[model samples]
Target: MISSTQVVTLARRPRGPLRAGDLAITDQALPPLRPGDVLVRNTWLSVDPSIRIRLAETTPDGYLPPFALGEPLAGLALGVVVDSRSPEFAVGQHVSHLCGFREHAVVRADGATLGGYGGLSVVDTLDHPPQWFLGPLGSSGLTAYAGVHAVLDVKHTDTVWVSAAAGAVGGLVAQLSRLRGATVVGSAGSPAKVEYLRERLGLDAAFDHRRSPLTDRLAETVPAGITAYFDSVGGDHLEAALDAMNPGGRVAVCGAIAAYDAETPPPGPRNLFQLVSKSITVQGYRAGSYNDLLPAMQREIGEHLAQGRMHYEETVFDGLESAPAALAAMLEGLTTGKTLVRLDENRS
Candidate 1:
């Protein structure tokens, strides 16, 4: 039985980019597991941009509550069950749960889930690395899957633009659209990420959004007009997409990273009227609501991984101590692909 563990806690709310002083690694005592509780030894922690939203004083409606000062941060994590009081889970089983930012977590097998995600569940690593479960095969994959198939309804004939295309979710969306024979245009913050989209991911066209006005970049990359868009960055990017969208275009709004770090929400796109004029469709969705599509998402992405038909990338920070820095870097677009924290490198 675990007695104590170190966890990352919110030391204070940050008005801008996160700094180490805003967070602290504190030790806490764990109580004896109750019946139906599963204790896990966490191996990998996911560092996502969405967490930035929660660091603010308030979150958007229907989203998770903000993290209070001195409370541990929760996120998607992969761990092996070390002790179990529940018949449903066995010791040594690998499970994914929301009790991350700590070396060990005590999960209630039947407890409430975080927006239908981060519930205690078993997972098989199969031939892939255990960490991959936290990346392409896990939440990131599910998000990309839902936005493309369930929301955007991308078709082969449609041209699609994926913002933040070099990141985890965007990269998958781009490749998935391409697999259906759609022409895919991607935008990233850096020339290197643009090169990655074109040379590594084989995107139809790619551009650095930071290099010029997004409207011009869109014209240069997708002059024919895109029929579909998978949006992560919301501000000017959404405005640009709206301007470049063809009549009857579809937009799957997953996140607003452009405003995640802002002290207050930025202004909405000034061109939203284009939706009415052009008969366009814009929908916002979260992965939790689309749980029914999980199996198909995992199977298809798994096959793509096995066949080498898809490419995935990650920026891993070593140790739990580095998580704060990792989050800051990811928020600044300083890291590429899926940002993650690797705990216990000697173990896995």
Candidate 2:
């Protein structure tokens, strides 16, 4: 009998820091394999800004249901198959998706292929860390691709601005915009992150959001005004972007990390009127809403990763016991890109 450790939800409402009491780690015995199911030993657990939203109560029309207290806390993950009863996924297949936070999982054979979609092929590690599956080559990459290419419709003449530009999605957006021949600028909270963007990510320009007035720096950085804004921080960032957008500009709302842990999110864009006067378009998007676009996204991002056109960053915690600290660090902007927990040490 394989003993597995899993993170289970324990709170009905999470108002501030997600405490140890909010999640319980427990052991469970594996059940007998059922037909068409495959057993996977998880290696990585993704800790994302979206997980905070998933934990909160929302309207019935919400894209996903709120995580139930006392149930396994589910999120995106990367794993390897240890056993299989299905022909599709044999033993040792590497996989990544929205699996619960556990050392092992019994996923449907189709689940291994991501809802049985043939276009999404699971590749074995290619000299890259398994954690990349949760970042650049995975959901974060797709989010950046869809927002810049589809929603914003960036062109060679455009000037792009990305908030939280050193993050997984924002960094990818900065790279994609540069690829499209657009001038790219980004805003980061620290001097280190700003340096990472300018020196490492090769952004056209990067500003320290905490030290500089965003609107003034934006006006100086792009005298012609921003034609596309990949918004990840929201609040003041959103207002500043709105104030600097040129006519016919497009804003792709990817995430609002600045407001995720707040007891109350600051009011929405104060400069929304700019959208009307400048004839700008603002659209909110979720990567899960664009599964049909995954094939093309995967192919494009894969090519970039293979050719060194893009780079991925991650802050990894060593064990399930470090989950809370990992999540807290991510929220505090102590991480450069994706944040995840490594369960290899605790695997059965």
Candidate 3:
């Protein structure tokens, strides 16, 4: 059996923005597999904004604890089981897991859960590229599905505005909402992404959040006032949504990427009283909490994907060492769609 493997670890806590120097890739010895242990040779690693929250000295209460200094950092990953001590996982089976940031992981069959979703599960790679499970068909897809359908319960008559709409989950939420016949507006960080949202994704309106004031763009696009908002970027974005929301509007809160790297948490949107006046329903959730919806999500989203009604983009780094740089770029909004690291190039 292989002995040593390279794994990404927290060397130092980041201050403002994350730097590659704050993370370290170190060699570690793999322990022998016990009963129910599956040895996974990781191939793809997901780089998510939520991870930035845990990298801070403290995570939001009721969330996962922060990664200890020098501890191996983990996130969603895809891999093939190279060895197995349990019949539950056969050798050569593909699996989706949370024990990532390493070349290998010894995952338990009935292991700890990720958020609320089960941590380790077999994934069939027949109809799709395996890495897609780390993106649209897996957690990203699930998050979007939960936000757009479950939390927001978007209606066809609704004009929905999706913030960070060019991102992994946001992009999926935009398309899913559009497929449901909503008039969709999307906001991104760049002009090119805006074009993608307009021309490619065929959103009703698309704008660069960096170009002008957010309120002005919202007015320009949906002058009638959006009836629903899908928010991944919090802070000013949340406040702006509150300002632009129509009476009886609904908002889905899935992520807060805006102040993820800030030294101190940004204050809550000052306009929350708008909820009382406008009868707006602002609901925050993690996809894992809505795990029961996965089957429904997979069927609808998978059908849309197969029929060309949906689109997904990914930014993949070439090596395990690149994971840190990937995380840094994603936090700086320098990456489009889902950012990931390619660990095993030999995978078919």
Candidate 4:
């Protein structure tokens, strides 16, 4: 008999700050696997900006299902199959899914996908770790790649600006745009991140978003106005980007991290009329809506990773207990690049 540990919700409709008290760690008895069920030993769990949206009772446009109180929280997770009744997933394969934040999970086998994490496709792959799949090769990478290539339509001559430029998605967006021959500039919350973007990520130029008078900084840096804006931090950043956009520029609305945890919703852009005058195109994007483009994006990113054109870093915490702190760090702009939690590191 195997026991499972899971992170369960203790609150309903989170109104204010999410604390450690909102989650409960409990044990459960595992049920016998059915014909198409597989028992997964979760290795890494993704802590992304989207998870904060899941806590709300009302999701914008009903794209996300409401979270059930007392139920296990679910998001993108990478795991290994310790036992399986399904032939598609063998006993030692690494896989990922929208699985629970549990040490052990019994997933409906037919739903789990395969064939990522170093392309080794076996036990040897686990030696290298499968957590990377949740970042670069996983949904995060796809989101960044597609946002720049498909949605924003970046060109060689374009000047690209990425908000929240130190994040997993934003970092990749800047790298991809640079690889595509665009002059990329990024905005991060701190000077350290601004330095990482410039010196480490090789961004053409970078700025600290927290600096005084962003419009003045942007005007000084980009005298010609920004040709493309990959906006991850909305609100003031969005307004500044609008004010700096050249005629016929493009904006990819990837995320609004600046306002995600805000108690009061920020006002809409007062300069939205600039969109009309500048003939700018601003489009809100959801990665799920663009999954079909993942293959091409993956191909490009895989080649970039292989050739050293793109690089990523992650701040990983151990155990489910660290999930909340990791999330809070990410929201507070304390984490660099991607943030993840390793529950069963040895398993991976």
TM-score result, candidate 3: 0.97
Summarize candidate 4's per-residue lDDT along 1-348 as a digit string, tens digits: 365556645455555656656666666667788897888888888888877766766556644665777767777787788888877788778777777477788888556332221111222233234666778777788788779878988889999999988998999999989988999999998989999999889999999988858888798878888999998888988899999999999999977876666566678789999989999999997776766776687667777877777778898988886776777677777899889988855542
Each model's RMSD to truth, in Å? 1.4, 3.1, 1.5, 3.6
lDDT of 2 by residue, 33-69 (tens): 8898778777888887766766665512544576776
**How well does model 3 score by local distance difference test?**
0.89
TM-score of each: 0.97, 0.87, 0.97, 0.89
RMSD of 1: 1.4
Which pairs clash (backbone N, Cα, C closer than 3 Å) in model 4? none
lDDT of 4 at 151: 94
Off by over 4 Å in 3: 345-348
Model 4 misplacement above 4 A: 8-17, 29-31, 110-129, 345-348
Each prediction's Cα lDDT score? 0.89, 0.77, 0.89, 0.78
Q: Which sections of candidate 2 miss by over 4 Å?
A: 17-21, 29-32, 57-60, 110-121, 124-128, 345-348
lDDT of 1 by residue, 120-188 (tens): 999998988888888888999989999889998788899999999988899999999999889999999
lDDT of 3 at 164: 90
